[model samples]
Target: MNGHALVVGEALVDIVRRAGSEPVEHVGGSPLNVALGLGRLGRAVQFVTRVGADERGTRIVEHLTAAGVALTPGSTSADRTATAQAELDEKGSARYEFDITWDPVEPPMTADVVLVHTGSIATVLEPGCDVVAELVALQSRTSTVSFDPNIRPALIADPARGRARIERLVTLADVVKASDEDLEWFAPGRDPLDTAREWLSRGPAVVAVTRGGAGAVAVCAAGTVEVPAVQVEVVDTVGAGDAFTAGLLDGLWSFGFVGIERQERLRDIGTAELRAALETAAWTSALTVARAGADLPTLAERVAARKVTR
Candidate 1:
């Protein structure tokens, strides 16, 4: 472990509905998953988010606690916990409808924290998004910053404004991960690699684009590196991207690129390091999609999965 991590975003329950099955509720939210995944991977993680003092909120807390993630004080400040209705298709991909509210208090900064991660709805929604942006900007000066714009089309009221918000955050981030679909929505008809290259120019040392089963590609100042997606019988795509983000952070930490002392070195990362990080991310994502809900893998599970592949 290099240094502690701070993850700020929403914590909600996912109400999953599939054909001929009862709806199942599970603790979920993009940043929440990343925090939990990092914790399960044996990294010290602190999470700050908003959820009502309700049953679903309790579930969310319990889930994070079980994963060994610490919840910041005052995180449960909402009137009602948010919920996302996830409808699973025949192929196990999910389409989501959200009944959510996001108005989070400013997160407290801790001196020991070396990585700050945030994104998804928390980066673009309401009064809270500004707080998130401020925190990332402040932390970027001293800690490695990672972002994943797990863009939900349903939540973005204005496409232009959403793109601007994502772009601004990208500049503050040392590492940025986006799905191919997210890039398509940001710049219609533009190649995702082109957008990744543009983001790299802005400031992010690494700009990664995940292409579902096609794999993922990363653009950096040194060059680009691509990784093939690990084959898995996906239960659902929920949390896969978040898991990848967690693994990417852990890989960077392992390389001594995550602490305040080494944060500046992240900007000069080489092609080999980028590929190794992406491979770790791919494994994390593959393990998550192999199970139901957003159940990310533990360190043991990841090791075992890799062994089987070998």
Candidate 2:
């Protein structure tokens, strides 16, 4: 919580198309959303991502600035800004068609960072994926590394290859978060909790899985604790997982579980404490789902939501 958080990944515009509604644009990407959510929570966060010199890219810059996320130098490109055409279903679930590039130059290592976060397309795509993997490896010795495999099946060409790339980062992470749907795709025919436990064995001190309406579960060396989702009227779950990741990281920081010196103790954190963190994550996601697009809740809003839930 004391040191800055470094988030490395993609920044794109989401062209959301719902029934009877014109396409709406929102600045989003897994890591970008996480950065925005952390900023809204009052964390000192820096975002390292690529955006074009286009209008969409300008919008992305404004959004991050408003959220208080510092943009890393050389975060822009001559290439056109990335865009995802998201078609929404009746239940507010989204299917995407992406038009983007993923080739980020190495970011400056100039910040006093305690936490480093990355994943999604940035971890699976070529060129940039290797750069991101190298960054995580370099930072793991000093920071609490967190990864979220916010999978987009359409973007992946080979399941086996994607799994290998994802596992590589899992090995470097202190914390790993994934949705139940992601687990199903990553390890077919295996139970989500079982897969999460397997991830813990790989290197991460903790593995947290979000189970939609059923809530979320965290698996660690100590044990597993599950927290049910907060009941709320649903909107599109656009950035729910990213918000959850931010909340989880925030909770971990609050519990003094960040940085290399304290990471070893993460596995030994009490189940009650882990549950509290999971609850925070679930509540954060609930707020995202209760709205449209990836409009994450502010810290004040999160506090008020907690009070109402209580």
Candidate 3:
């Protein structure tokens, strides 16, 4: 995209239970993971979330800078950084327990952004939601909007409230990514495809559903596409979904879906160009899962691996 992307959400620390009943700290949060994923994939990204002004927050900043992600500033607070405890199963899927800060500090100007990505605690948590709404309002004038309802039931004290919050977010987002779990959580008895279709009607240009291990599907009025998942050895899937969303965003950006680059200008681009970007994201995520926590690979590594595979 011609302009940069602004990723707004929480930047929490991930605590993984280690060998002896102790939790090892990691630099992760769903939004941070997405921003880092996008940044490492050669996307010009700006992180717009608040973190605690502690060592954890410093690590997040270091990690972002290392990944070449820009920051909007004035987001970090005097409070402790939000924390999450992930219990890994034998199959590498994790159950989470999070301790997140509710107070967000000051907001920043997002006038130059081409797209705004928000959801997660930015949708449900206090102050974060307000900040997200503010950013969405800015995107209405400056850029397109993308959101992922990265739903974790444990984080929502009330399911009804969570779904309602997500509904409110859907109205503002141009695109949305949700998991099967999020669908089931929102409407236990309703059909997922139907729910996604409903959300698409709610005004998002597209709605995507991620099915772990099986792959993901994107529904747009133009058409629908189902992406097959890569077969990989099991490792804790802490941020794979975020990686997937990052991949999708990368594809859309390169394709000129946002206003910064008109879609007509990219009409000549073929699926091969699009597929390469998506494939890189999936491959990087697969590599991350091969390790523990959010150990994401750089775009150069992904590109080099693609060349070898070819």
TM-score of each model, in listed order: 0.97, 0.98, 0.89
Q: State how far residue 275 of model 1 sits from its true place (Å).
A: 1.0
Q: Give a tens-digit lDDT track for model 2, residues 162-187.
A: 99999999999999999999999999
Q: Which candidate is the best by lDDT?
A: 2
The whole-model C-alpha lDDT of candidate 1 against the native structure comes to: 0.90
lDDT computed for candidate 2: 0.91
Which ten residues in a row are the worst by lDDT in model 1? 255-264
Name the 10 consecutive residues with the lowest summed lDDT in model 2.
103-112
- The C-alpha RMSD in Å for every predicted model, in order, reads 1.1, 1.0, 2.8
By TM-score, is 2 or 3 better? 2
Q: Candidates sorted by lDDT, descending order?
A: 2, 1, 3
Model 2 regions lying over 4 Å from their true place: none
Model 1 reaches what TM-score against the true structure?
A: 0.97
Model 1 per-residue lDDT tens digits across residues 146-238: 999999988999888888999999998889999999999888999989998998899888899999999999998889999999999988898
Show pairs that collide, candidate 1: none
